[model samples]
Target: MHTHTSTVTSDSPLFDADGVLLHRHPDLWFEDGSVVCRAENTLFFVHMSQLARHSVCFRDMFSIGTHSTGTEASIKSESGVDEFPDYPVITLHDSAEDVGNLFTALYDGPNFGNNDPLDFRVVSGVLRLSTKYIIDGLREKAIVHLSQAWPTTLKGWDTREDTARSFEMKTGSSSGHMYPSPIAVINLAREVDAPTLLPSAFYDLCRYTYSQIFEPSEDDPLYVPLTYSNASPAASPGPHSGPMQLSLSDTQRLCLGKESALHAITGLIQSMSHSQSIRNSGVQLQSAFSFSHPLAQNPAHSAIIPHASNHHNPYHIHFSNHRRSSSNLICVSAAACRKDFSELVELATQHYVFDRERGFSDPLYVADELGQLKSAEFSNSDAPECKACARSLELWAARERERIWRMVPVWFRLSMDVGAERTASPPVVDIN
Candidate 1:
């Protein structure tokens, strides 16, 4: 004898038999809709035609006999009795907010042209559902929106940094106010398998201290909502209702990436201190700026500076015995220019770039600070002469920053083509 297994479907209106009230979405609930979707405590009454139009998953589900109005498909209370006006109900495993955002994108055609704080919320929520339901158009749109905020190019990163600085200067507020928390971005990137977003996201997350990464405070931007709809009340404990935690794999990625960033900081200092050819000019080295390098103080530090005839090193500024040409800007008072470069490098080391207490892990910020040495405020009163050498220094710093930016994906161990603007699956991170 063959035994039949009957599946109970929960599709009741308003409330289930368990007294669990399902809140109907204020904006998404259409009275004349053909289907109802229950996501946790929320209910969305939407048209099946529209769902099938945007989502292949829904269309496939409908193509099967699952939407039938047979007794097996009828609404069943907790007690297994049929009830309610017969509308086909589908239960979504995703959060109600995500479902709502997905529908909003599908119906309204992805309008994300706002500078609000909740922009990440809408993009992330919609992206999750769109990717899940195989909505290619919506998924691509969401990726574009995400890539704009957390861009792939070095120029885009520079623009984003400049905009944050501008916002900070104009409003006298923390630059953190202008962008979403990178921790949240990292989480979203992993959740949606968007590997292209990982490099910038991981680099941005390194801006926070070691403590801040693991133990974000109450005011931390990580707690910001991933989706905020003015039309709907707050969601209960759900996917995006609270701050998201990184998986052990992601945490390992972050910790290792942060260490690499610190090493890059040392690399910036070296590039500023050593990697320049005073160029066809006679610049004599001076002992004006001979402070021990911050890295040299560490016990595990390597001898990055070797003993050479008054030449470039972290501890001393040495130059070749080439004759100075009075006509050349860098060659004119070359010793003074060398001293000025050394002094500015020391100033940047102690106050701006390499200070560990300040927790400055941002190589781009370090590069920008190093580049700012061209100004009279940083250099000697002889702005014309000092600026010539400072310009070379600035160029070197810019190049170092670009190099570091390119290495970000490698540092994070993300298997992404950093040169390309496309998504990939999250790499299988090995915590072991």
Candidate 2:
């Protein structure tokens, strides 16, 4: 606020009228300030040092002796009169509300309100201007807020303790208001090129029907933001209403990502469901007759141990089955073994489709399980009815996990031996 400390003329009312005439916004007014920033024809009185500290863009701009838009851009006039100087105004193209939101986070200390669920407007504004102005501190703060909404890592996703993720309006017609959609967040993420937020945002989007995902107002591309003033709740409220939205190109990319994920995962699951030919892999299942099968009836065959101490012994399995022919290998407790195998499959499937409350559109789960290396989960909990059956089942399960491990990248649809391109369908099952 600037005022004439001295009376310009006697009729000017000496020592009576207010000193300054700059219009001040309710939310943006700072009792003490260095310069005024204008946005959408609205003026925000703020401190120069505070803006400089938080934003390199603002810092660099402030460093210039002149404001680029006005006479401040040039050296003082020959008469030494400033270029319409009313506290060195810097005009910005952003909306007044957005600019005000951004400054509140900055000058008031980023987390001033201490609200659990953030005001969506504040979060979006901070992210937008912070990124635009190269405000690393504020950008990081906004990313922290974003991480709460979309966990960046499996661990973070698993531990929902990160924060109660939600959004609301702080004040205005929308005070205490909840925005029913994440589209706002999603659109803002895209506008800001925020990749970390994409996976969860896209996953959240998948839950909505195509029509529900996009509102009719979205066609305008400009009319969808339920501005804080006179904002109306989206008539059909669900989980994803906000200013952020997916662009057509982004929507197509998401479709591709989903297709690739499902295809690779389905292929991996199919490959894992069937038994592999172990003999071709230099592994064999031996007759354990230890459980009183025909082979165990032959005392001589029962003498061979699991060969645990001798890696020299070729991989083999022993089972008690009625028909012991040259090819068909069977487990004495075939049902139990099958049940155990199913549990592993369930884990693999869960990994592929979803994990840590996060999502997967592909067979990254194969690599994830393989990375864990404990793929074969064996539970001797109640003990199998037959020791020979248990032994054979254990050996078979272990061998299968090892085989799967060796073919992880392949199971994940990688065509190359190490990391070839993944196919949407299962690779040819190697008979060998």
Candidate 3:
């Protein structure tokens, strides 16, 4: 229970509870009932009574002598001389540098080449002691060892025989690959913004399958067949079930008609002079069909005008006489309308004039118009006869207009004129 205090000075003896003198190192002292030690370049004070109670061996060793000579001799003469002391020696010095070097020798050891487990144990012991005593160098070295050890151990797993070996080689053996599942892989990719490792062909197949299942259209008869075969359709009927219940055969027929109409419209538009001319020509044809007879309305049976000049000039043609029957002008069927309109779009795209035409003359405008017509209100109704006829005429007109519009471009018009002139002039072929 004796309490003593001392200031660190040269040749101070650090003592334990039994009044045992531990070390006569350069640092250690007692003053005002407290013991002071220099560690990591700083002065630390502890009550002599508390130090004595907590470190009995330290006190006994200290009481023995100022240096470890007597203690070493006694330990050598006793059993198990090689055993480390149960308690470590605490030193006190006037300067932090002296104590730091002593601690480093004990902790790091004079030579790191000695791989003895005792050396490692000593290093660990010194780290705990340094922490308790606030020895900065020892604490820092301990932290370095702790930080470097785990990663080194993990990297060693690379040589192990396991399925994870390949993965380790590629991505490294961090906790990142410890337990990856399909869901986890997907989540990780999304979280890290990484690309999925799927192939391009897989992506294409997925897209094709998706389109086959979900591409919108009331006219598609295979809607049911394609839908029933796909998981997406079964899970979610989507927004257009009523109109999409068409038979597979019906869908095929509709697709063929649509394609044919598109080709026909495209060809006609390609032949037109100006977008306006196509519109005018369409109006004229509607009028002609409406006034003549039902027999005249057959698009397939009608003879096509071989030359542009032979056809009535669209600019001069008027629908005034057929105004009363304008709505009755049956031109083409509804099923063929979309195809025909697509052809007009192609023509208009080719003949685009940046400034002359307004909104309705544009290809986008024609596409919008066709899009509106194909919506539920038009295509899903029961008026197939009237709807089909009206759609066909509109399709043809739109195509003609687009073709003419495309022709208005300076480059296209010039090319056409040159081709025409060349055709008019007979080729000079020399036979050898």
Candidate 4:
């Protein structure tokens, strides 16, 4: 067999050096393979035809000459007597595990089993190498797997959250373990030019406390395993093995996005309990509840305080003066509805909605909690919110959550295209 002989330029001992060893990829090596590809310390004996068929980069390279100018080395045959041809070794500038994963996907197909946390390594490896090699099919598949965690649309986001919540309930651990770390996800998204993944990643990362994001402690809840064990053979040390950090620019964007998310929750609270709305109902609703806290006494806390000294109700005055008919007022029992609204506002404020220390500043979680106020379990009052008032608040909170989802890209300073594609419903992906 004709052989391509060339010198190895790696820092390690020369290929022919005594006692030097190279690991052959367990799955990718084929006896009849026509070419060799080396990534870091591992070598893959794979057929050139399959790679050429799927990757434009490989096709173009093979057309010219496969690794003609790169490192070349010979290996002993099974008998250790005859030597295999010194196949041209295409030195890939990627990690061995990543190359192994890429070849596995190329041969066995990307198995993203149930989009499990461990699947992230495979997905990311395939994504990185596939994009580099211009393997569009693998790249697209990897993205589908990623989308299972970092969804684009609000509905998809909710589904992802529900799955995570369920996982947490089952495992008694932080739901963060259900998916790969968002810091790693963000970095991979940037590396692969997949901006669509950023908003969801950023939003997920926002759930962590500022210290957790910036300086995670050794016993950080984000790293703790519940039921999921990383010791499984399928699990390898990956980006989640340690505190992966965002780039300085990404860090800045994350900070801005986090602050914006906090403000979004505050904005929702303010909108739901605006001063004008409070003043209109305060005098009548004041009979329902009184402020015991000093901060609640200040009118400046209108976002949480519903009591206002203003006696005039513009809608009532408008009706009393015969300027508008009573039918013009949409709320039939303004006092009762307003009373319920104030109690709900107070309930939300008292919760961890604004407490970064408690790591409950996530707008989605806060909004969901608000939505559940219509349910009996989350209601603190003697009576649940009136059907009309509760339903209105629930619907408005749902819409507001969607609006916040849409604004995530804007918050992170991502391009409008990121938000545009994400606004639509997520397309179904078969991950079998």
Candidate 5:
């Protein structure tokens, strides 16, 4: 006849038939008359009679100790076994299997006395042991603590050189050779969300890096200008030589349209002046007394024609002269000089139809005419247009004279050669 064996899964603690707690390996159990255990990574089975003497217990198979005549006294006596040497202490009132489960839970949970020194030592020791056993969780926890404690403990190794060496020593050759620099440490802090240490380390690293990269030399020009200005004479050539001298082409390239033309003219005038061979030529002022208006034959040089009393004269009267033909002679007041000069320059530059048709032979004649009018005396009563035109011409002449003067050397010998002469007579006026 064949016999059938049944298996039962129970939440109750595992125990021997006599009800004594049994300390079995994780993959072992004791139920009814069977002893089931794993050894050397393999399962094995035996009867209670075949079990080792040390592996068996009597009196309430789940109990830590045997029940005696005085049960309370025996329980009390056994309870104190935890304080005795060479006695195994029971942490939980359950079978050895339940106790094993509880130990694993405590090891994995936060209730493992996280703040205690002894707990830390135990955890570290377990982690070290786990590395040999290839326990993933324990090894990972060890790494986390090591990385977290680095900033606080690695004080002397805050510099790049020191940090690199320390990291190498801690992790060993294979893993340690890839140690981070101080800058990398700061970056790691940022990655790991260490708020307090990250910013401080980051700033320090930045400053150090900048200092290394941009260290100033003793002879650097920028340093002299920025540093020793007060201690030294102001005229001393700063470490910098001088303002950079630009070429004409470069200046022209940088200049705006009208500004470029102006700079070109200024440079030309400066060059001419610097050459020193150029003479200081004089400009001629036209003789106002001899000037004749083209519009009328034998026109009066000075005359004042009265206007109607009812009409208001916009200009104030200066000196008015009545000479020959009833001509009104007027000179611009100083106040109206600016407006007249502006208008005359505009009129002089304009290409009038009459001037183009006539094919004017003498460009100098127009300039002379403008110059003559500019010298004409005028009161405030004179027409603003005439006064404005005269004043504008005077300003134009002054500016032109200045421009011409800039092209001449400040001092030059007057030579009789080339039609130039030193005469006892007053200087001849030449307005070219």
Candidate 6:
């Protein structure tokens, strides 16, 4: 699903247009290079036989008109692209970076060996170009990694922390730092017939703020850079600045998914809050409020809670002390803890430190929140808290996390788990 931009050369021309029959990128020119792969203004020096061996498309394309007699050769007549008399120039419709990366992956020895580039852009480029150019094996590898990030089973989902995952960024930008663009992931999943990936991808996408969804800042993970293309060096690129644009339906799907996820989480919180054991336990302690905390307990109000996101489309949650609190602090057990449904959700949200713009409806945030119940240090000498209650809450969170994980496909309105997908019945005997 790569959006190709028709390359337009700078009006100044590459060294006097007439003198230059073709422009070769010095960065990619190889001494033994046989073929020239052109995408936008970028050109890559590569071997034809190597490309032909891996991609049936390249094989079939190269196989066409192999013996064109003397001087005649197949060349693209598109503007700004000049066919040269030297090596064969195979013009393509994808971005230069994508084409370059695809060829890099193809030519690179060991097939995903050491020092191989596997960032969001590179993997995405490999996925799209491999599928398009019919490169063997790369597509499946890309799919496997993506599937690992967004598994089809609760087992895979629950054991995500244990898995050799690389979805998060080192800088810690929450929803914005580590993962690929949610919209891009969703679109690519649809394009590749990967329905199993939709649930997690959609859920992750729903966590982005409206601005992050559209115009992600330079600091945000979704922010796309201006790629070097034929459309002048000064021209900006990437999803928001260039050819990649979302359809109306894409917007609706994301909004709907976010809204649904919010409702489900809210319901789960309410249900967890009303447990009979949670209400009756009598424990008193000082408020866990601090200046650094956005929403902390206040003496004026009976309770302290964050403002729930607006209930309209493009909705998001915010932590505002001015908000009328929907949650109250109460001891879950006699462990001297006073935090109710709202408070629990709030604590969990804080643990993950989700994007302020999008709030915390993310499934990942929920898992982290639950994990914190057992691990969070509450027994400070000044604010001495309960470890027993923490352990109990941790167990409950584990159970709830499992339940939520199972219902992911359902929440996205999919029926993948029905029928034979659940089990393999013994083969019926035809002897009767």
Please, what are the lDDT tens digits per residue for candidate 6 over residues 264-323? 565544444443133332344322221112223234322221233343211112223223
Candidate 4 clashing pairs, residues 3+ apart or interchain: none
Candidate 5: misplaced stretches above 4 Å?
A: 1-20, 23-115, 146-152, 155-432
lDDT by residue for model 3 (174-265), tens: 32232211121222212222222111111111211223324634332113323321112212133444313223432343344333334433
Residue 229, model 6: Cα distance from true site in angstroms: 7.1
The reply for model 6, stretches above 4 Å from the true place, is 1-21, 25-36, 41-45, 65-89, 110-118, 146-175, 215-219, 225-245, 278-359, 367-390, 413-432
Task: Give Cα distance to truth, residue 5, candidate 6, Å.
Answer: 33
Q: What TM-score would every model get versus the actual structure? A: 0.73, 0.50, 0.17, 0.73, 0.16, 0.59
Worst 10 residues of 4 by lDDT: 313-322
- Off-target runs (Cα >4 Å) in candidate 4 are 1-19, 66-72, 76-82, 224-242, 275-333, 353-359, 377-385, 416-432
Error of 6 at 429 (Å): 51
- Taking all chains together, the TM-score of candidate 2 against the true structure is 0.50
The C-alpha lDDT values of all candidates are 0.61, 0.46, 0.31, 0.62, 0.29, 0.50
lDDT of 2 by residue, 244-356 (tens): 34566666755554554456555555554453212222343332322322233344432232323333222233322222432344343445545654665676667655632
Native-vs-model 3 lDDT?
0.31
Better lDDT candidate (3, 6): 6
Error of 6 at 137 (Å): 0.8
The sequence of per-residue lDDT tens digits that candidate 4 reaches over residues 205-249 is 887887777666655644533333222122233434445667889
Error of 2 at 41 (Å): 4.4
Arrange candidates, best lDDT first. Answer: 4, 1, 6, 2, 3, 5
